[model samples]
Target: MTALPIHPDQRTPSDTSVPVSESFVSIQGEGKLTGVPSWFLRLAGCNLRCRWCDTPYASWEPESVSRPVDELCEEMRATGLRHAVLTGGEPMIFPQLLPLTERLHRMGVHITIETAGTVTRPGVRCHLMSLSPKLANSTPVGDPRDPSGKWAERHEHRRLNFASLNELIAGSPDRQIKFVVTGPDDLPEIESVLARVDGWKPDDIILMPEGVTVPDPDEVAWVVEACRTRGWRYGDRLHIRLFGDTKGT
Candidate 1:
């Protein structure tokens, strides 16, 4: 499945492009579309540095190779897959994504954008807007991943943009809001944030346990109970379990 949707890859510098991390055909491991077969386009570069970001290859040190969107579209057409996931270190950061998503959608591909909900691009179309809003737990404060404590400060400042978050939710009816929950303490912050954001029902929210490896039984039970009590959905990273966090799954 080289034909599956993925970040653009270019042959020449003249080609219009976005930095590509990788691409793969895999079951969606998280969010509302969990267990769905989907092609993933992992674009590189992220504005925020989360302490537990699984794909540091795509975020902390993104691929330097800029890939052509036109080439990617050609491959996508050949894949014969209806679902195309435009994921990234943060796909919304690339304006080139407008054309990329437009072409894929026009090809009759059901586009699903996996974004952190910090950025928004108007005029983009997708069947599903899988918004994984970074919570306070994502801040890299004092985490060894950011040894200099540089990204720690910057990540905290850029993690949440309510203006963009609201726009993403308000613009799409077929969208899911997800938050990675680290512990029971994260519950109150989620409640407070949702109260401020516009246009989402309790059912629209999804609470995901934070881990790449199989989470402990206690964590799973806690998240399930949290969802049961709050009218939210529980999200799991099935791909991680199925593929062991490896690339091109």
Candidate 2:
């Protein structure tokens, strides 16, 4: 039930230019479109810092080259792939995505935006809105990599945006909400989120195990059983299972 801070300047025209972390063709790892061949465009920058986040390079110490919409479209065209995934850091934070998704649509690519559902941009086009709302388990803490602990408070403050989650679900033709579960203890928080989102069905919910290269077998089994009991779907990190945590799949 956390509310996002008001930032009127959050959606400005300058956001049309994005910091490109990395782009590559890979198999869809999680959610409904698992196993689908997709061209991934990983953008930099995010509002929340999940403690179990797999891609720290894109969040904690983000480094990337700024690329224009047209340039990114051309890169996807070169891949000759039909499916395109706009992932992050947090893709919705950038307003440039409106143009990026529009251009990709014209190229006849099916777009899937992988997001934490903390921000919403109505103008952006998306085929599948893959919403992975952060649970309490994602609360950040001090680490050697980030000694200041600045991200801890910031992450807790912005992790959940019920308004954005509803808007994204209402607008998209298809949507899948995934939750990275640390253990059985996270179930109540997931239920609370589900209770807030009207019209969410069991089929629309997916549970994934937390980990980078490989999900712990015990955790996966526990989640699988939980999914069975709740009638929700279990999602596997296919890319990780196949290629470990290697970059670019």
Candidate 3:
């Protein structure tokens, strides 16, 4: 996706032209900086199809709407918010996101990226990087039994790639590993990734529940106990509880 051109008058659209699904202002409801005012930019496509995806509107087919980047940036600035969260169907898919984010930085906005931990780029300098590593429970594209079997099968080749995790984490300070636990079955995968990524203290890892609309209190308690045992922290999806997973808060 490419950024949209600015109109000479400079009155731009609310969204960006870089193939956006939606954009608006909301509190950062997840990750390290939860409960912070942040402008949300949801991109239009994703490489992986997790079973419990909450924002299918954006992830399933975001390419259908192409927004101009100038308009999108203007939309963000108008919000009067100091923070911006760049999220996706895999936002890294849009090569132009670098320029979009760079402009945001120039505006003194603190930027955060919520990604699936597969792709990487050097220029999209975000202040906070929330990378959720895909697990086996995350359906690979094209696996028919996957809840969205039809969609997954068609996009299997474009499944999320873990090729950039190393570079992204090398010098990142305001970053965290967020793992969505689906019952007890998901813990092993988290352990495996942690073991591979040495020096990632448990304090830097956040275990969250997998519910889309709302997190179960029981699950949160279980995760908290597990984190206590492992020395990690438990993160709850604040938006899901406060807004029931609806868009635009």
Candidate 4:
């Protein structure tokens, strides 16, 4: 992978214990496994901060609770669920996920790693590599979320790592490129991002409406239309619709 000057805080803490924000049993709300029942392992800490980050507790001001992989795996086994999602605050930052997924795979659990596609995990094994690359709109330039008003530049520079994204795409046998589209014009930017990343198929691309809560119907329709015209899949924030963006499904 090519070198990039990622900010110190942007990198996951190189500690033995995996930092967990929250873990729960929720339906697969996005991508191909939209309605399937699955266990969500929402790890804490993120490299980049999004302007409209839905899980601010896991990112903007992360709630860190150290939990070991064995303990986390035990929680998954207790769930009695077959499908599992290793999601984040950018889960890729936490290397413990590599071993965590490894353990889950041995237990016959189908794992999905939801990431921003900025960090590459060569040994990361999963049934699905859900890649959600943050777009330009996600930058917190003048956003109040960033108290120092510095993440705009920091996040913008660290957000899109094509080299790492390409490695991640190449490593995973099954993968999806999910983009959180906030406007109609984001299509071009999305297309441009796809061009830089190598070996992504048309079916692997998914477009999700950008919002913490339920998005406007008109906004959702535009995303649907974009998907129809481009032959990409439309991803819905079902959790937001059903639970109104609350924690733990």
For residues 59-130, write the lDDT of model 4, one tens digit per residue: 988897898777788889999999999887999887676677667877988888899988886566677778
lDDT of each residue in 1-249, candidate 2, tens digit only: 112232444334533568999999989988888898999999988888888888888998887999877778888999888999999899998877777877787788899999999898866778888999999899877666557888787888888889889998887878899998888899999999998986578998999888875766765788989999989999888888898998787
Cα displacement (Å) at residue 143, model 3: 6.9
Model 1: ten consecutive residues of lowest lDDT = 1-10
In lDDT terms, how accurate is model 3? 0.72
Error of 4 at 120 (Å): 1.0
Worst 10 residues of 2 by lDDT: 1-10
Choose the strongest candidate by TM-score: 2
Identify the superior model by lDDT, candidate 1 or candidate 4.
4
Q: Which predicted model would earn the best lDDT?
A: 2
* Ranking according to lDDT, highest score first: 2, 4, 1, 3
lDDT of 3 by residue, 1-249 (tens): 122343232222334467777788778888778899988988888777766677777664344468777777788889899888899878866676767876787788888888876777655657777878866666644544456467555444443344577666663556788887776777887787777764466678998877776655664777878888998888777887788868776
- Model 1 gets an lDDT of 0.81
Flag regions of model 4 displaced more than 4 Å: 1-16
| Each candidate: RMSD | 5.1, 4.7, 5.7, 5.1
Indicate whether candidate 1 or candidate 3 has the larger lDDT.
Answer: 1
lDDT of 2: 0.84
Deviation of model 4 at 2, angstroms: 23
In order of appearance, the predictions have TM-scores of 0.90, 0.91, 0.83, 0.90
